[model samples]
Target: MEDALRRQQTERLVDHLERMGPGRVWRPVVDRDGTVLAEGGGPLPDNLEEYISGVDFAGKSVVDLGSNLGFYSFLAARRGARRVLGLDIDADAVLGARMLAALHGMGGVDFEVCDFLKTPPSIKADMVLAIDFIGRAVVAKGRLDQVLATVARLARREIVLTMRAVYPLEGLPPLEPGLRERYAKHISDGKFHAARYAAHALGHAWKGRTIHEGRVDGYVLKSVLVFSSNVAETWEEQGGSS
Candidate 1:
C-alpha cells in the first residue's frame, strides 16, 4: 500500500513539472526521495559551496532575491536556516516553488512573487542572495544602483551577490527581436560590464568583501560579494571604500 501511494505521488509531481515547462533554470529542483522535478539548461553550480564559503545560514533568516525556482532557498532551509523566503518576479516560478516546498514538506520555506527593484519585501533578513540577477538587470533596465540600495536596506547581517564579471571576450550576439530591442539601448550605452556595473550600483555607502571571484562558464565570470550592514556603516564612517 505504501509503495502504491508513493508511486501515485511521484506521478502527480511529474505532472506538475510538465505543466511548468522545462526551460532556462539555474538549478535542478528535486523531491525528498530524489525524484527530479525540473531540469535546468544551465550547468549545475557545483561550486556553490565555495561561493558561500564563509557565510553560515544555520539559525539565520535568509531571503533569496530572484529566487527563480527556490533552489538556494531550499538549500538554506536544509542547512538549518530558521526562516527562508524565496522571492521572484515570475509568478509561475513562484507558484512552482511553493508547490515544490509543499511537496517536500518544508514548512520553514516560503515563496512569493516580488519585484526586487520596485517593491522588495519589507522584512529584513540575516542573509540575502542575489545570484545571476545583476547581469540580467544590466541588460533589462540598467537600474543596478537602485536594486543594490534596496538589497542593502533589506539585508541585516550579510548579502551574497553573484553576477557575471567583465572579461575580454567577444561581445554578446544580438538577442531575439523583442529582447534585442529592449536591450539595445543599454547595450549601446555600455552598461553590461561587471566592474562598471558594480561601481555604479554600489555607489551608495555599502561595503562589500569579495568572497569568490572566478569563472563559472566560458562566457560568465561569477563573482560573490559579501556585505554586512553593520560593517558597511562602520566602513563609511571610517571613510573606507563603499
Candidate 2:
C-alpha cells in the first residue's frame, strides 16, 4: 500500500510535467505495464527492444546520451545491466525520467542533467547509446562530429547510434502531393550513403545495422548503426584513415 501511494504521488509529478513542465515530451515514456505516462507528439520510437535485447548487458555498464525520457535506460536495467546512466540537458526530461524510475521502483538506473555537446561528462561505460534524434540533431547543428567523438570515447565495448534523416536511404511512405514533392527532393534520389556518412562522422564503420522508415512532419525516416567498440578502434587504426 505504501508503494502504491508513492506511485500515485510520482504519477502526479509526471502529470505536472505534461501539464506545465516540459510541455511536449519529445518521446513517450512508457512504464512496465506499457502505459504511456507522458505522451510524445513526435514519431514513435523505433524498434529498440530487439536492439537492446541483443546486447549482453550482464555485468555491463551502459550510458545513454540524449536519453530524453530514459526509456532505454530503464530498459537496460531490465536487461540486467550492472549500471545504467542516462544523460540529457533538459531538466524537465531528467525530472520526468527520475519520477518514472521511482514510480516503477526501477532503482538500477540514474539520470543526470548534462549537455554532452557543450560539456562532455567524465563518465565511461561498457556500452554507449545515442539513439534516434541525437544523430540528426547534432548533424543539423554542425555538431555531429564532436558529439560522435564523445560518444565513441564514452564507450568501452560498443556503441549504438541512430540517425533520423538516413530515411533517404530506403523507401519512403507516400505523403500528400505537395508534401511528397518537397520530400522527393529532400531524399536526394534515395541515396544518402549512410555507411560512409557514419564512417566519417563517427570515424568507425558499423558491424551491423537496421533501418525503420517512419515519416515525421510530413517527411522523414530512421536508420540505426550498431558498432562494436573493439572492431571500431581497430578499423580506425588500420583502414578508416581519411
Question: TM-score winner among the candidates?
Answer: 1
Clashes of each: 0, 0
TM-score of each: 0.74, 0.72
In terms of lDDT, the poorest run of 10 residues in model 2 is 233-242
Q: Cα miss at 83, model 2 (Å)? A: 0.4
Candidate 2 lDDT tens digits, 80-168: 88899999988777887888778778877999999887889898899888875454334444455566788877888778766653534
Which candidate has the top score in lDDT? Answer: 1
Model 2 steric clash total = 0
Candidate-wise lDDT, in order:
0.66, 0.64
